[model samples]
Target: MKALILAGGKGTRLWPLSRELMPKQFVRFIDGESLFQKTVKRALLFSRPEELFVVTNRDYRFRVLDDLRELDVEVPTGNVLLEPVGRNTLPAIFWGMKTIQEMFGDSVVAVLPSDHLIDANEDYLTAFKRAERLAKNYLVAFGIKPTRPHTGYGYIKPGEAIEGGYRVEEFREKPDIETAKRYVEANYLWNSGMFALDTELFIDEVKRHAPEVYAAFENASTVGEAYVEVPDVSIDYGLMEKTEEAAVVPLNVYWNDLGSFDAIYDALEKDGNGNAIKVRGKNAYHLGIRSRDNLIMTERLTATVGVEDLIIIDTGDALLIARRGEGQRVREVYRQLKERNDERVLVHRTAYRPWGSYTVLEENDRYKIKRLTVLPGKKLSLQMHYHRSEHWVVVRGTARVAVGDREILLRPGESTFIPAGVRHRLENPGRIVLEVIETQIGEYLGEDDIVRFEDDFGREGDG
Candidate 1:
């Protein structure tokens, strides 16, 4: 079966760590592997590298490529579908199914979300096999047997027993605590958001129940054109709930979407006092006294006293502290920040680019300091800032610099200055990664004050 990994969600509930440019799927949270990487590894269990596909936002193209490179997995580049805009799960799935049909013709495609944490053990393999069997006759959704009353996940009620699974009787929305308890009592399964779909069956179902969506993609010349007309509807809403072909295969495995801080807390290892502490960076550590049942994640030294059932997340640029049960509401903070056009809503102090990454060291109204790390053989765009002048001090490796007509090479401790409106480019010509300290002085230091003359990444506008 071919695999279609969805890596497009923003994961706003995990804000302060998960941002627009770097969503939770791309963030390394477990054992040096991003969730996306783990999902890729999981996909490989059922598919070869050549058969694997990914659907993600256009903004995440480089990140997806980087992750694949890290895994040493060579999926066909064209197989990576970049969505022009998010039109929810149905459109993304349809695009993947259509592509799979066009290439492999009526194959079984496993649809998996990249941000989920799943134990890809024997059970997982067996469950997918079961789902794939069901997919021949039904649009199969792998349903996790509910371990507890979880109000955060949608519930699926299974109907008459089929060959390897049961027909999906009803699809229920996320419920209140009392309703969730009732669901658990009734043996409702948590919607796993994973599917094993027969390309032809899925297409037929969409054509029958969601004709608008089917027409949008079938009639369009490009994915972008189709997206322009497709409504933002999920597969569950647009197809599964309305289709007679829906089937649910029970998947008994350790699965967690990590949708909220509370979920993260539950997934983490805890101390004797029930405190889950995760510290990033060498010098970062957490000390807690009377801090039972608290989830504390930090990048620097953090000490807590007399705290219980609290979620504390510190990512250098922002900190989130909330009561454990209120984790679902964290997205409200993200929405509020977005409403105010706060940069924190979009990125951390360190921002990633196609070329490399840069971390803000200091910034004020008139000046900004950044530590830029450019990978070997990589270069920034050939561009100039209209509002800011830049001073670059090389701290490591060698930098081939271009300041208008003057081309120069800078080694460790060497520096260069580019006046405002003067074109300049920084390239790492050495084998080692290049690190540079950049100081910008100007009246306006917004990232949008740039014009790209040449770019290797096909990027045209603001970074």
Candidate 2:
């Protein structure tokens, strides 16, 4: 069976850490491995790398490529489908299914999210076997056995047994605590955001139910064109709730969406005081006196006194302090910042580009300083800025710098300048990372206002 992974969500609930350029899937939170990597590793357990497809937005294309490359599990870059805009799950899944039909005709496909944690390795295999048997006549969805009265997830009620799975009786949204307890008492399973279906069968149902979406994809010549016209909706609202061929297979798996800080805290190993403390180095000390059930992640020594049920995340440029359960409401903070045109809401202190990454070390009204790291064998786009003039000093490795019309190779402690409106590009020809200190002197030194003459990553006028 082919595997389809959805990796395009903004993950606004996980703010301060998850930014526009880098979402939660790519960030390493629970363990050293990212959620996307974990999901890919899980996907590989059943399907080969060749049989996997990642559906994400154009903005996340490079991050996806970089993450997959780091894993050393190379798949065809073309298999990573780039959506022009996010139209939610319906279009994304439909596009993947259509592509699967073209590549491997009428095959069974499993749809999974890239940011969820599930360890049903054995149970998952069993569920897949059941799903394959049932997918001939039903669109099978995996349901998790609820451990508590969780109001964050939807509920799936299973009817009498039908071959390998049960007929789906009804689907319910997140209910009140009493209602959730009632659901648990009645043996309703938590709706796991996973589905296994026959590609041809799913397409047929979409054609019958979500014909507008079907028409959009069917008429377009390329994935980009299809994405431009596809209406933004979800599968549950468009097809699953309307179709008659729905079935649920009870999957006894350890699953958590990790949608909040509390969920993340629960997933991590806690200390003696029921706190999750992540220290930078062994020499650093975190003295938490009278603190309980808190999460403290920092790059330096962080001490918490008389604090409980809080989330303290320090990313150098931004520090977030919020009540434990209120982490999901961090979207409101993002919205407020966005309304005020704050860059902190969109980009992080350390912004990643295709060539490398840059961190805003310091900034002010007249000048701004940045620490730029260019990966070996990669070059920044040959571009020019209209408002800012830059001075670059090589700190670690050698840099091949192009300033205006003059080309020069600079070693450690070497410096160069590019006047405003002059074409320039930075390249690294060595085997190590090229670290440089860039100081900018300009009136308005925003990230925009750049004219690219050439680019290697095909990123221009897109962001």
Candidate 3:
């Protein structure tokens, strides 16, 4: 058996904390371990490191690698499939299944989404084992028995009883509150988006039900080529709902997709006043005098006087305040910001890179300041800014600086200058992490001002 983890969702509903660059899966919301890491651990319970696979976009490549590194789990780098562009779940899963077929030949593959919160208890293992047993002939989906009337998740109605599972009667869309209540009353399961797929069975189903997607990958030489021709469709619409071989396995385990702030509120521990508070960074605290049944997440001192059933998220850069039931509308704010090309929709104060990370201290029309941290033995791409001249001051450790034709080493309190159009690179030569305060001044200080001549992490064309 093999495992394929999907980690490419944007998580727009969790904005102000989750961004286009750092989605919720990579965010360390529990015990300093990302949801992606937790999902990897769950996959390891059934499959070995070499048999595990991950399908994600190029934007999350380093993040996935860094998370796996921190977990001390060694998954073969080749098993990490990087999609050139996202084409929804169907294409992603098909790509993984095709690869599995080519490598292992008709294996049972567990498909798990990386951002979900699921309890890996005895029930979870048993449910997946049952799904695998049915996967030889059925494209099996693990359906969570509805705990309540949830309007957020799609519902699956089971038909005839089968061994360890049931044949699917219908796949219903997300419903209104009244419809959701009916679904719960009828014993419908919440679509968990987890699956046990036999590569051969899944491939045959794709060919039978979704010939367009099947043909797209059939002729394409590379994943990127296939993505260009593939339509954006989910597995539910493209294959599962249309296939006769669909089956649903009841997974009676604790499962939460954490799709919205309301879900987050439900998952968190509440105080006596029924307020859930999560404070990040140093000296951050929340004081709620008369607040009850509220979720407050902050990075600084916050005081709420008389709020109830509210969601307050403060991330130093942007803050979101909303009613508890209105969590799904947060995606509207993300969509609006995206329409305006707002940077806040894409990144926070700090941004991560393969080499290390950089935090924006301040920025204006003609200048910007950033604190850059480079990991030991890592170097920035050999690049030049056409419009911006940069001044770097070593704040900690040692910096190996290359300017135009000269290379020099700078220690703490030392500084260097690189004029516009002058190619330069920063590196950490010592064992300690290097920290530098960089100031850029020019007519245009956008990130796209870069022109890379060489790169270490295959990011030569990127700005």
Any idea how many clashes model 1 has? 0
lDDT (0-100) at residue 359 of candidate 1? 96
Model 1 misses residue 417 by how many Å?
Answer: 0.1
TM for every model, in the order presented, reads 0.98, 0.96, 0.98
TM-score between candidate 3 and the true structure? 0.98
lDDT of 2 by residue, 1-463 (tens): 8899999998877777778778889888677888999989888878899999999988899888988988998988868998888999999999998888899899888899999988957888898889988987888888999999987789998998898789998888889889999999999999888899899899999999999899999999977788788898888889888899999998998899988777777778899889987665456657888999998877667888899999988766678899888877888987887889888867777888888899898999978999999999999998998888999999999999998889999999999999998999999999999999999999989888788888998865512
Worst 10 residues of 3 by lDDT: 26-35
Model 2, CA-based lDDT: 0.88
The parts of candidate 2 lying over 4 Å away from their true place are 279-285, 460-463
lDDT tens per residue, model 3, 139-223: 9999999889999999999999999999999999999999999999999999999999999999999999999999999999877
lDDT value, residue 47 of candidate 2:
89
Q: Candidate 1: where is the Cα deviation over 4 Å?
A: 461-463
Q: List clashing residue pairs in candidate 3.
A: none
lDDT of each: 0.93, 0.88, 0.94
For candidate 2, list the clashing residue pairs, or say none: none
> Candidate 1 lDDT, tens digit per residue, 45-134?
989998899999998999999999989999897899999999999999999999988988889999999999999889899989888888
In order of lDDT, best first, we have 3, 1, 2
